[model samples]
Target: MSTISLTARALLLDMDGTLVNSDAVVERVWRGWAERMGIAPERVFAIMHGRQGYSTMAELLPARPMAENRADNAVLLAQEVADTEGVVPIPGAPAFLTAIERIPHALVTSADTALADARMTAAGLRMPDVRITAESVSASKPDPEGFLKGAAELGVDPADCVVFEDSAAGIAAARAAGMRVVGVGARAASLAPTAFAPTLERVAVTATADGGVRLAVSP
Candidate 1:
């Protein structure tokens, strides 16, 4: 595919599946929960990505009380911290992150603050100074709240921001925020992103003369 170029004043990035690869632990948690709940693992995985644990629980166990869902979500969060078995940064993500360090960037994730912290640490990714976690927004991905909050906190207009995401929910959120999105994985392509890449291996970030950031996304 031809390269896609994007220039923006600020960057918004998703944590899981975008910058970090924690598929093993994420799948393990959901599959275990699915089995215990007498639901299919496929059903759990389908709604698990780019969404808050509580939200996923609510969707999975619709008849359950909010209080019960909250308690179960807490347990999931705790398990995530202790289970980083296959956590690692995506290929070329370290350099890509360094290249944009001087620019206005925020980590916007559906995971809770504590869970995001643990996973990022396990993947050897330095936590960004600005972050929008599950607790940071009343509504989660597919709602546009987190990305909107991230852009606002970075003092950049939504149109001036570029988002990196790997899931349909996150991609939808970025688009809803009026930001151009660079889809980060194979699954992202089906979401109709502005740019799509299977991995960050060939992605390039350059600082433009006008103090803007340029992302050269290669296939």
Candidate 2:
């Protein structure tokens, strides 16, 4: 086990796997999509996490048109919203969010507004005032556009922000944005996060005298 401490002007967070536990919904939708696309379900699982549905569709069916990908993504979004069966907050997520109540933060997610809203609702999480959804960005994670946009909206420089992320794509996005990242899952460590924790339960937040926030993570 190890501990990490950092101070930042703002926090950029990822939605699905980071804040809300939507593994079941993600797997269910993508598995069905894989079957339809004739790709192996496990293969879809490998590339789909932390990516926009359209991006995943395009990746899975490279020869498909953008229009076709968009249409398929729309269907996936609807299915995800309608089937929020195991969605809930990740461990310690509730208190972690509550502690950061007065801090500047934004949710950067590959999910669209409808799916984001539905999953958050299913998880009993209130959306932060600032959010970047699929509709908010042209490209998805590992592209850095969403994270940079999120920092821009928060009025913080990318270098001064710390991201909390659970997916490989999200961590890569944060790094590409020039922000340090606290990887939020067991697999996160292999991605070279500034710190890795199994769950948010091990994280503690405190406000500094200069108005920045401090994070102490023990894993």
Candidate 3:
């Protein structure tokens, strides 16, 4: 197992590609939206991950008024919640979640509460005790609001939390929140996170002799 230093008292995790496999459902729903809006599906896909639907729609449909974009985004989100069949846990997510439950952990996601719950339930993964959804933050990923809110809800200092993230937005949020970040996907390598592991399955956390925890990434 590979190892890295961690100075945190808690863990903050991102829900989508980091812990669950909802890419198919996300892409499908966004593709439909792209068709309806006459936007490029690939462009929509590129901007939507780790971002709020409203934020994504605003970015994708910049010509549209915010009210119109919000309405369209709500429709798409409703469709996704209604069609949650394809959502599943990422490989080893169950085991990783179980392992971390012994410690304080929170889920910080760009998704709102309803969609976050739907995806978590569909994946058969237990929701974290403390969760900061899009509804809980005025600013989203790459802004640090979500991660900071999550740490606050868990009653931990931002510097006392370790964040597990899969996207550049999330990594930026964690870093801005003064947390150590473990990047958990191929894209992670480019983010220059504190540690980069291919998947959560390859990550391990253990108590250190100094009474803090150490995070390890298995090669």
**Highest-scoring model, TM-score:** 2
Q: Against the true structure, candidate 1 has what lDDT?
A: 0.90
Clashes of each: 0, 0, 0
- Per-residue lDDT over 15-133 for candidate 2, one digit per residue giving the tens place of the 0 to 100 score: 87788889988898888888977899988888788988888878878888999999888998999989999999989888888988899999999999989899888989878999999
**Candidate 2: C-alpha lDDT:** 0.89
Which residue pairs show backbone clashes in model 2? none
Candidate 3 residue lDDT tens string, 111-202: 87889899999999999878888779887688899988888887888888889888877888888888888888776777888887788788
TM per prediction:
0.96, 0.97, 0.92
lDDT of 1 at 141: 83
**Given candidate 1, what's the lDDT at residue 39?**
96
TM-score of 1: 0.96
Worst 10 residues of 2 by lDDT: 183-192
Give me the displacement of residue 93 in model 3, in angstroms.
1.1
Per residue, candidate 1 scores C-alpha lDDT tens digits across 1-219 of 799999999999999999999989989987888899999999988888998877888888889998887888889888988899999999888888888889899999998888899988998988889999988998878899999999999999999999999998899899889999999887787888899888988688999887789989986
lDDT of candidate 3?
Answer: 0.83
Q: Give the root-mean-square deviation of each candidate in angstroms.
A: 1.1, 1.0, 2.0
| Pairs of residues at least 3 apart in sequence or in different chains that clash in candidate 3 | none
